[model samples]
Target chain A: DTAVSQTPKYLVTQMGNDKSIKCEQNLGHDTMYWYKQDSKKFLKIMFSYNNKELIINETVPNRFSPKSPDKAHLNLHINSLELGDSAVYFCASSQDVWGVSSYNSPLHFGNGTRLTVT
Target chain B: SQQGEEDPQALSIQEGENATMNCSYKTSINNLQWYRQNSGRGLVHLILIRSNEREKHSGRLRVTLDTSKKSSSLLITASRAADTASYFCATDHLYGNKLVFGAGTILRVKS
Candidate 1:
């Protein structure tokens, strides 16, 4: 079974349209994260949720909002997307929020959702 | 800000040859990890080395961590064509839970 999965593997939209990506993890992890990978293949953290609580917000614009209904699911909604919003969004999960303590628990990533804004 | 910076953004090598990638981080880290991502796929965890540990080995993969230098290296031996992928280093802070990833090194192993 796929431990982590995200919907809408590919998204192509206009410049001003809004869209959402859904992510789910079956690993029973407490920490989930949203990451953005640009064309240059630089992966950057956008948001992180620990057991449905917002823990890290990495200076991302307000246009991008992450909602975690529960510890198993985390969704991202992009509002008024711009041309620069085009990138690959990945969903990842770990055992807990503290990476140091969870020595053997590395992040489990899902196949990314590629979004393109014209 | 991105903490880890990897050397040689791209590399190409023949099958059976070894590939090495180096990563340098700005701050102190509790542990360092290496991940691999193939084309059109998600990142896969390769190995992790703690700050107190100097080196670790997993099958054909070898990882080295130097806390004093705030740097790490990943070495893959007897690489095959299937080993062609982007390798990334992620550093986990001593106090925080987040993992900062480096710009990956793309490896192309020609069989």
Candidate 2:
């Protein structure tokens, strides 16, 4: 089974539209994250939740909000998207927020959702 | 604020050859990790090396961490055509809880 999965592998929407990307992980992880990769392949963190509690918000715009209904699922909802919002969104999970603390803990990522705003 | 920056944004090598990518971070880190992402796919975790350690190996992948220099390198031996992908270096801070990723190095392993 796929460890982590995100819905709508591809999304295309007009500017000012609202959209949501759903993510779920069967890895039984404690922390989940949302990342955005631009055309230059620069990956940036958007939000992070540790056990369903918000732990990190990397100066992301208010229009981009992350919702973690539970520890296993985190969804991103974007409102009034702009041209700059076009990028690939990836969902990732880790056993704990700390990396390599106990036996090389690393982040497991989903295939990613490519969002395009025109 | 980028945590890690990888040099030589892209590299191409023939199969069976070794490929090395370097990463430099600005902050003190608890651990460094390497990930591989094939075209049109999510990234796959490759390996992780703690700040207290200097080197680590897993199959054909070798990772080295230099805490004093705040840099790391990932070397893939006997690279295969299937290894053609973008490799990224991510760092988890010693005091912070977030894992930050670098720009990434695109590797094209030709057959």
Candidate 3:
């Protein structure tokens, strides 16, 4: 079974359209994250949730919002998407949120959602 | 801002050859991790080396971390055609839950 899974592996939408991507982890991890990989393959953290609590929110635009309904799921909702939002979005999870014991707690990532705005 | 920067944005090698990628970060970290991403796919965790460790090995992969220099290197020996993918280095900082990732190094192994 896939430890982490994201729905809508590929998404294409016109500009100004809103979209949402869903992520779920069966690894029983406490922390989940959302990352965006741009055309240049630069991956950047957008948000993180620890046990359904917002833990990390980068300086991403207001259009991007992350919601965790429960410990096992985190979803991303983008409003009025722009052309620059075209990229691959990945969902990842880890057993712990602290880095103290993180050496052994590597992240497990989902296959990713490819979003393209025309 | 990117937490780490990987050298050689792209690398091409023949099968059976060794491929090495270097990563340099700007902050103190508790551990550094290596992840692999195939085209249009989610990343796969490869290995992690703690800040206190200088070197680590797993199967055909070797990872080195230098805390003082804030740098790390990943070596994949006897690369296979299937090994062709983008490799990324990520850092887990001492204070945050987020793992900062570097711009990936794309490796193409020709058979």
Best by the DockQ measure:
3
lDDT of 2 by residue, A1-118 (tens): 9999999899999999999999999999998999999999888888989889998898899999899989999999999999999999999998876542543368899999999999
Interface RMSD of 1: 2.0
Chain B of candidate 2 achieves a TM-score of 0.97
Which scores higher on DockQ, 1 or 2?
1
- Give per-residue CA lDDT, model 1, range B28-104, as digits (tens): 88788999999999999999888889999999999998888888999999999999999999988866668989999
What DockQ score does model 2 reach against the true complex? 0.61
Please give the lDDT score for candidate 2: 0.90
In candidate 2, stretches whose alpha carbon ends up further than 4 angstroms from where it belongs are A98-104
- Model-by-model lDDT, in order? 0.92, 0.90, 0.90
List candidate 3 stretches off by more than 4 Å: A99-104
Q: What range of 10 consecutive residues in model 1 chain A has the weakest lDDT sum?
A: A96-105
lDDT of 1 by residue, A1-75 (tens): 899999999999998898999999999999999999999999998999999999889889999999999999999
iRMSD, per candidate, in listed order: 2.0, 2.4, 1.9
In order of appearance, the predictions have TM-scores of: 0.96, 0.95, 0.95
TM-score for chain A, candidates 1 onward in order: 0.95, 0.94, 0.95
Model 3 chain A scores worst on lDDT over the 10 consecutive residues at: A96-105
Score residue A30 of candidate 3 by CA lDDT: 92
Evaluate residue A26 in candidate 1 and report its C-alpha lDDT on the 0 to 100 scale: 99
Which residue pairs clash in candidate 3?
A: none
